[model samples]
Target chain A: MANNLNTRKAKQKTLTVLKFVFLFIYLVVVMFPFLWMLTTSFKPSSEINGPVDYIPNNPTMENYINMLVKGNFGKYMLNSLISSTFAAAVATFCGILAGYVISRFNFRMKTPVYLLFMITQMIPSFIMLAPLYQMLSKAGMTNSLGTLAILYANMTIPFSVVTMSGFYAGVSNSIEEAAWIDGCGYVRALFSVIVPLLLPGIAATAIFAFMNSWNELFMAVMFVDMDKFKTITVGLNSLILKYNIKWGEMAAGTVLALVPTMFLFGFAQKYMIEGLTAGSVKG
Target chain B: MKSNKRLGQRRNIFIFCMLLPAILLPLIFTYYPLIKGGVMAFQNYTLMDIKNVSWCGFDNFANILSNEAGVDFGQIAKNTVIWVVVSLALQFTLGFALSLMLKKKFKGAGLYQGLIFFPYAVSGFLIGIMWRWMFNGSNGVINDLLMNLGLIETNVGWLAQKETALLSCMIANVWYGIPFFTIMITAALRGVAPELYEAADMDGASKIQQFFNVTVPSIKSVLLMTVLMRVIWIFNFPDLIYSMTSGGPANSSQIITSYMMTLVYSMDYGKASAVGLMVIAFLAIFTLVYMGATKYTSED
Candidate 1:
């Protein structure tokens, strides 16, 4: 009996070692690319060509300079920043107010409208891809960054509503009823009572909108033209196509594209989990 | 009292009017695009040269189906299936396991959750580029690391080679997708009643046994919904394909979206829209199946 217990303890210890080993390896697997991208961003031109040579004997910042200075990184970043941020802000504003109405209203067609908004999220983005490109192009809205913002806002509002509606459901109706009885109108109650309660939900919805627009490549790739209008995804993609084998510059540009979301995610780390999980698990 | 009721009715109408913008946007932007695509599929159009238009009917699709017409779209369709299924299986399996790990309280659990979900926030295009760099043939990190470790005798050109290309794409895709399941499943796990586990424990059931009997059933609703949504997403999105390989190594990994993009860019509008139509058809069928299954399962 003593021997069996001792052996079991030893086995458990071995399991701990194996479990940690697995985790460590998985971390390496995930983080390896990020590390490599960083390394590749500084590699000299000669060493950038091969399969097994991401590192350079003589590292340089020349590639980074070339990418930003020559490749319009500032313009691209600014374009993405302006368009995506605009989209997020506009979507959040309308989405929250509308989500509140849908949640609290006893109007006709409420369920259908909500269902329509829900289904919008599930439609293959590709089905809309060509047509949106066509229609927007015809409208002459494709060229402007504002057009991109509108497109982004349109894509994100469904998701924003679905998640935000769920959140408003959680934000007790009694509070709003109290405000209603105090001679506050529905709009005033929504603005003063319900809106404040939905701060966390709005934050999550904003993040989702921002992330969608930031990561958006299809719209960016299809519509935008000229150097000044290229968002980061399209810009980096075009950079790679035009300058194949320019490893450092490509890496630098890609990393630059990654920064905003990385910053946002880091700041609001807690809500990313709750916001994504809530609607996701529920739906 | 009569005036108050009238006021209430008026308020409801006003509330709905406020929802008009949200409603109108999707109607125009979302559904209109789909309707446009439905029509556009029938016309030979390159907006760049819209003057030289012709009606192709279903000729684009027919050519692909007949194969003698030499479009080779059958290959693209086959690749789309492979991309979706392979990704779905891997993400579900790994995500399930990761969620299982997170079910237990641990030191730095928050940090672990944060790290795991970080990939989901990383842009798909960047994931494509990051993987492309890692899979770089001669001087890439994967080869370098493997060579240094003395694990492999030769450098493997992961994304560049036909055989390895789709699998390499899957590696990055799986990374991006796993976090989604983990987040959803973990949330489900939180909602799972501890009473079920307690009862199972009283029966002297093993931990693994309790997991299967209690945990699985409890999270089944969440599992069903998340899986449905995920299946739809992976089937539709070919973004990784666009960025990673661009349907390269002889179009071996050309999912439908990438194929459609190539055709459209080259002004084969009739064929591209036909391909786009095929994707919509698939999605429509898939959504029907998903909703049917959800309704069916939930009923029982």
Candidate 2:
């Protein structure tokens, strides 16, 4: 009996050590790219092509300065900010209304409408690529930031609606009903009673929508031709196409582009997880 | 009774008004483009000759299938299949393992979760560029590390080589995809009741047996749906390939969607539309089969 207990303890220790080893390896894998990018961004152009060093021997801010001053990265950042914000705002606004109605009301054709929204989530955005471009071009709306915002909002709305509805489904209807009995209309109750409760969900959906627009490359590259109106992703692609491989500047640009989403993700990590898992868990 | 009826009608109108933007935006942007794309697939359309476009009736599809005009559609289709399948397998396995590891509570677990999930927030295009630099032939971190460890004697041109180009892109894609599975599976795993595992333990089941019998069955639907969604998304994804290799090294890494993008770039709208339609059709069929298989199995 003592022998068996000793063997069990030994086996448990081995498993624990194995788990740590695996976790350490995963940590390395997840972190290596970002660490490399961070290091490369600070390296001088001369040292960039030299033997790869984990840490830059002589770090410099020249790349960031050059990107800001001469590369028009600032303008691109502004464009990205404008479009992403607009898209997220509009998508979330529309999502809240649609989500509320779907979750609260029992109407005819509700199942069909909900299914349509779900189906939209499955359809690849590429299928819409050619015709969307053609339609926008025909209307002479291509290359405009406002049009890009609308397009991004369209791409983000389905998921936003689904997420918003899931959040709404979580909140009990009793409070809203009480507000209704107290002589508040539906819109007033939504704003006064329910909207505050849904703040975290709204923030999560907004961050997701913003990230979608900010990270979008295919449509941005395809639709926008003008340099001034290009988003960060498009600008980075153009930089690659135009320049002879400038690794330092490119790395710096990538780091800068990653800032907003990373910052948002850091603060809203819980909400982001909740939002992304809503479909899988609740469905 | 008349007043109540009037109020019901007004409420319905209010609901409709509230949903106007959500309903109308998709109709104008999504369904409209989808229908137009189907129509454009059969028409001879070009951005340059839009005014004089006419019906072509499957010629574009025929041309692509036949490998006319040096497009090598067959090769592209094969590459796409390999890309999606290989990347999906790796990402799913790694992600599942990570999720399992993370399911156990430990010190700094939240920090690790944040770090692991950070990559999903990064743009695929930026990830492509970062990986492209890392895989550079002469002075890349990957080569530097490999050489230091004496694993490789020479710096291999990972992205530049024809054989390794697609694989390199897949590596980047897998990196980007891992967090998605990790986030999803972790969430699903968290939802699994601990009572199930305790019940299995009382039955003298080992950890492996419990995982297969209890954990797997519980997360089966989430796993199936996530995998299906990923397969379709990865199949349609062209951003990483486009940004990293641009379908280069003699189009060895070229996938169908990237080929479609090239067609679009060259202003061959009809061909692009045809390719788009083919992608939609393939995904539609695949989704149907997948849903059917899952439904059939769940009935057991």
Model 1 ranges with Cα > 4 A deviation: A1-18, A50-57, A280-283, B52-54, B149-151, B294-300
TM-score of each: 0.93, 0.96
lDDT of 1 by residue, A5-66 (tens): 89979988997777667666767766777777888778777667744454567888888788
Residue B85 alpha-carbon offset, candidate 1, angstroms: 1.2
Can you tell me the CAPRI class of model 1? medium
The iRMS of the candidates, in order, is 2.6, 2.4
Report lDDT per candidate.
0.79, 0.88
The residue pairs found clashing in candidate 1 are A50-B138, A50-B139, A51-B137, A51-B138, A51-B139, A51-B140, A52-B138, A52-B139, A52-B140, A53-B139
